[model samples]
Target: MRGNIIVRIEHDCQDLPPERRSDLVTRRLRFLSDAEILDLASRRERQYPGRNLHPVSITLPADVLERLQRLQGSRWSVSALIDRILTDSGKA
Candidate 1:
């Protein structure tokens, strides 16, 4: 659950005193429990489909990059599409 939700909350009230913190906060939340926590527990695999998945950097020739762009889908992410192609070709 902790890994699924990565929150980076920034606030300007840190410099202010404790009594004045709430006055400048944008909003507040109070809940007994959240349904999202339960959903996250069941959503591990869908988050990352396979093992050894990580980022890489490479320089492809302009012609090759342009050709790969044609196969990229509008909805599918560029990296995911490339990964599928590489996996199918047994290169990954």
Candidate 2:
């Protein structure tokens, strides 16, 4: 998988725009050969085990979310807030 590696996932992302829920973006894409695809998968398995495979989700009242966002301002993201709560309560 040494020289077999060509375009990387990071490099692929670099050709695109930063992601935003409110904006549409396009990424430069290329067709990968089977060997390249296999290499990419293997590389990812080693590099980011369990990443995005399992995600936790929750639902809260719109007003509650809005209030929290206003209180925290730009200091915290909703994801970070949830992570902190879980950690603080030992649910993590």
Candidate 1: stretches off by over 4 Å? 1-52, 69-74
True-vs-predicted CA distance for residue 87, candidate 1, Å: 1.1
| Model 2 root-mean-square deviation | 19.9
> Which candidate's lDDT is highest?
1
Question: What C-alpha lDDT values do all the predictions have?
Answer: 0.30, 0.30
Clashing pairs in 2: none
Give stretches of model 2 more than 4 Å off.
Answer: 1-54, 71-74
Error of model 1, residue 2, in angstroms: 40
Q: lDDT of model 2 at residue 78?
A: 39
TM-score of each model, in listed order: 0.33, 0.33
Backbone clashes, each candidate: 0, 0
Give one digit per residue, the lDDT tens place, for model 1 in 1-92. 01111112222223344333221111111111223212221222345444444443333434434433443334334344333333333334
TM-score, structure 2 vs. true: 0.33
